[model samples]
Target: MRIRTRGYERRRRELELLIVADIVTIFAWVLGFYGLHPNGHIDFLNPWLTIVVLVPLGAHVANRHLAADADAILLPLATLLNGLGYVMIGVLDPTQAHLQALWTLISVFAYVVCIFFVRNPDSLDRYRYLLAILGIGLLFSPMLPGIGENIGGERLWVHLGSLSFQPVEVSKLLLAIFLTSLLVEKRDLLARLRGGGLRRFGPIALTFGLALAIMAVEKDVGFALLIFVTFVLVMWIGTGNRIYLLFGAVTFVLGLVVGGAVLPQVHQRISVWLDPWKHAATTGYQLIQAQYAFGIGGLSGTGLGLSHPTVPVATSDFIFAAFGQELGLLGTSAIIISFLLLIGAGLRVALRAHGEFSSLLAMTMTIILALQTFFILAGVIRVLPLTGMTLPFLAYGGSSLLTNYILLAILMRISHRSNQFNDLREGTTG
Candidate 1:
């Protein structure tokens, strides 16, 4: 009884710390976000949005502290990283910080509700099934009547009365989670695919073809690459197979060739990367301005509220430019360091998880967030051609913001479980 009491007390304390961290992080982002907004964009909506997002967070974190597996930590960590990104974006563009804060409200609520619904980690597979059904539904949602298409030249979004959602995002997440769960169930079969045999070629071809088809239809080569690369990496991690890695590399190369030939955007991105200044006023304008921000920032930057890099949509697609102009490389480096911390924390949780599902899920979550960040940063830096991924938590998008919140909340729940397990081992509970 004494040991159980101590265990309960220890978990209570850890939950308290989690809550404190959430509050501090939220407050810090709010202040930083407000400080960075462009002039005259201020409004009461920002505070309201922040509350809307955090309220659900408060509920789930409360559950996490109580040692609820249903509460999990995946969402917590995802949100934390996103909030970091959001804060980075917010602090540099005061004008739209309020808008981001507003979107955040709905985003956080969606995430919290999802986390609660998935409380039984054993039942996550069922949730994955439901999500897949909805994901497929959304994947074809744009084809339905009366949805305003043409977001960044991609028909991935569906508009509904003052709101828009990118079905592709939901599809990607559902597909990834579904794939991970399937791979786990068929871990042995998946592991066998790495033998480099001719038999392996068929499955690889199907996977590559299907993924290419999605990206081809979406006209988003970047998203396709992100998904392909993630699958290869995670498969190797899951099954310890070298063939998946090599096969993935070969297929990826083929994909690039096939995609570039058929898609003008794919070719255009490559051309822009080679020489952005050539198309500065049209297709390459965002990148050109982004480069200008980096160049103007130099070593120290123009300082807060002073950069010429605050592009028209600084709170969204070109957010990094705003940071580049305002905070310079030094500030940007700090943001990168924070991202590193979040990744490290995620990896630690995956390594320490108690089950295959937990471990696989945690690792995939890390990979997705890492790849997403890389996708955005690479686009911004011209390492790759441009793609329109909101910089995770930082970009001013409602769906993306909500997605991150769910991610982080799940991470925190995982962390809580790890802590409980540790406390059990230490016999210091209560």
Candidate 2:
């Protein structure tokens, strides 16, 4: 009875912290929105703004009531990051904030669905092949006639009537599930250094290679690179094999070189990345503006909407730059720290998971989020060639936002189950 009481008290405290974090996030968004538009007073009656502020809190309450053992930090961290994204979007483009609010509601709904259905991550293994096929099909759907749309030189968007979204966003999560399931099942076989030859790893290699090839053809170098890096990480971690990692790195570099030589768009991006000033008037214009935004914002930010740095796609690809301009280096660092904390929580869940499949799933999802975040961050700062990937929670994209929420939901579910298992084991031993 005492142990149960302590457990209840701890959960109650966690719920309190989660609620406070959600409230703080809502306040930050409201304050930032008004700060950006000083002339426009806060409209407490604005239905969308009210929904934006309430949904996260409501989600937390629902999760606590439904999944009392869900990771307390995960949802709150995501909520704060997402709220910051909303504020940045509100500052850069008010229209996008409106759309983002709608997407947030939709994402919350998705999160609830995930929490309710995905009780056991291991059960997903049975449908790995089906999920893989569906994932690949979604990735390919953007190429279909009349439904396909190209934006920012990347043919990655699929339009159906009035609705348009990036199929790869959904595909990324599906593929993560498929890869986690497959890797767990064949860990030993794939990790073996001898025997079986090409037949053993050929199918896995072909699947990933075909996906990368399609992404390259679609001019989504960012997504291709992301997929490549994630596949390598998952393979390496799942199998504990360094040879596969080295081979993947070598193959990836070769692919980049060959693709750069063959594709004009790839060639252009590489050239711009190598010397942005040389092509400032043409391909490097955005990078130049981004650099200027960073320079203008030194240690502290320009303080929301004070400096209007005109970088193309500031709300999406170069959002970090826009954020750096408004919130400064310190603010940007805080955002990065939030992501690091989220990753840390995910790794903890992976480490604590009871089953191999659940462990691999949590680890793979964490790697995907971390890699995607690093890719976009490195690209924006010129640490690597810009591949135009959306920054996880901070970038302004409906599909990306929704996909991340689903990922968070799964992580929370896994964490809850792991905790339950640990508690049961303790009780048995006690």
Candidate 3:
């Protein structure tokens, strides 16, 4: 639906007030960094950073999802992103990696916030159409300007000057929406796919088979695994189908074997996972460093700015390592607990939503959040082979931060509406 003004003006005003609070937090952070580098100019104060702050606010004014149901959590999320960006900018400057994070922070933030701000969150029904466009786009995103295949053997990123955006980020959002739309539409039928009969066989099996085929061609086991897991979970959640769950497990194993055999890269990831120390000089360095950080951190961290983040790209793909190194295991555990809270909160919103589509949106988004957290954390802890995906809010990627922010915004909106719906039924709002 097109963005429009509803009764969200009050909510928007409230968000503005929250932004002020965020700016205050940022100011204190920047000042501390400046004090740390008194002789060195703190360039965190840049035109680019301003763009990050302003454009998303502008786009949100255009897109309109913000006001439908403002929640307190959204404020904190924005603050987290900006704060991390400040840290990345200050830390990486001495290292001399470009401020890609800052740029992405600006453009995508504007794009996503506008999407939620202009429209009533209650009106955001779903992004089926947008998701479709993104799906088609991802099919050829590797062909976009400045997009060259990365070292992981996937052409997932599209670069622009010093900044690179993961076009697949858009695809992830689209794919989740598409899956949620299907599950919600077919809930009753798929819900019946338990131990019923051959007629109840999982059609998702065939769809996943196709994904495995395509991803195999690209040799991207990680993407394949993520999409496959998403489908199975959404199906299970919607229908309560235990058989579908079992089938997914079996198929996942089959796919893993096939992937390992057909894709040398997949073999390498698993090999590295099995013994990262063997490949410590090559592919295993990140995980090795990650383990070291956690092992040394013990409970309370070494304290922020105190630990050595020897892992490459500590702010992005391995931000958790940064957390582990600086904040220690206790800090890392807090972050993990926060995600668990987000998952619980998102599921509660799904359960309470008034409509199936809205429920699907919440459930699908929650799955996205859970899987994203699982993906990177699993990689860091060596539960799964290393993949090049980023940690969600804490990671220093613009596209990821933007996508997650929008997801959180949508969830908060749904929760607020669901609560309001219950209140009306209970005659509280009136």
Candidate 4:
């Protein structure tokens, strides 16, 4: 009885914290909007705009009431980050804000659906191959004749009449599920196989390698790298083998070298990363402009809307550079901190997961989010070649927002199950 009472108290506190955090997130959204457009007034009662802020808060309330055992901090942190992204998009381009709001609604809907339906994370194992095929199909669908569309030299988007989206965004989640299921089932076989580690996991490695190859062929290098890194990390965790990590790192570097030599786009990006000014007129233009944004935004910022740095795609790929220009170092750091909190909460869930499948699923999901964030952040700062990846949760894209929310929902569900398992164990011991 005492143990049950403690568990109930803990869940109650978690729910309370989630509610407060979501309220604070909404406040931040409003504050950011008003700060950006001080003289410009907004109709607070506007249904379209009001739903933008209220949808996430409403989702939080529903999640707490429905999935009270879910990770307390994950939803609120994601809400804050999503809200921050919406504000940045609104400031950068008012036209797209409504579209982003619509996407937010869709993403929240997906989140709710996942929480309600995917109660047993382990059930995903049954459809691993099916999910893998769907993921691969989606990744390559952008190459099809009618529906495929190329934007900014990357053939990543697909169009269906009026609607357009990056199919790989959905593919990432499906691939994560497929990989998690595969690893959990094959972990022991991988560890205790007769042949050496490489041979044993060769089929699995080749399968993912083929997917990465497809992504590379499509010129979606960022997603390819993300898939590669996530695959290698999960393999390392699942097999407890250091060789896979070492081999993967070496192979990645070698692939980059070969790719840079053979692929003009890859070569150009590498050259620009080496020195943005030399090619500033052509390939290096965006990076150079981004550098300028960071330079002008040294400490606090130029103040929102006061100085508009002309960064190409400021609402999407280079959104961080825009944030740096307006929000400055302090504001950007706060954004980073929010992401850190989110990633940390995800890792907590992974660690607390009761079953192998749930644990691997949670960890892989977190890795996917973390890797995407790192790739984009590093690219923006010129620490790595610019890969044209959207910043997770904080980038203006319906596909990305929806995919990430689904990832969060899965994490929450796994956390909820883990908490229940822990409670059961405690009750039994008591």
TM-score winner among the candidates? 2
CA RMSD, predictions in order: 4.1, 2.1, 5.1, 2.5
For all predicted structures, in order, the TM-scores are: 0.83, 0.94, 0.81, 0.93
TM-score of 2: 0.94
Mark the regions of model 2 whose C-alpha exceeds 4 Å error after superposition: 1-14, 428-430
| Candidates 3 and 4 compared by lDDT, better number | 4
lDDT of 3 by residue, 1-430 (tens): 6443333553565457548745753564465455455566656566545554554455344324444443444444444444544554455343322354454555455546544562444344366667666675774576655564565677666776766667666677677777677677667767773444554454576557756754765555656677778878778877886877898888888877887898787889899999998999988887898888787777886654445467777767777876676667776776777677667767878888877777878888888878877988898888988767777766666677667766766776666666667756776422
True-structure lDDT of candidate 1: 0.67
lDDT, candidate 1, 37-141, per-residue tens: 545444545564365346545655556444453323344444454555455555655545566666676666665675556554545665767876776777767
Candidate 2 lDDT over residue span 324-417, tens digit each: 8877899889989999999999999999988998899999889989999998888888998888889988789999999999999888888878
Task: Record all residue pairs in model 4 with backbone atoms less than 3 Å apart, i.e. clashing.
Answer: none
Model 2 lDDT vs. the true structure? Answer: 0.82
Ranking by TM-score: 2, 4, 1, 3
As a whole number from 0 to 100, the lDDT of residue 181 in candidate 1 is 82
Model 4 spans with C-alpha error above 4 angstroms: 1-38, 192-194, 428-430
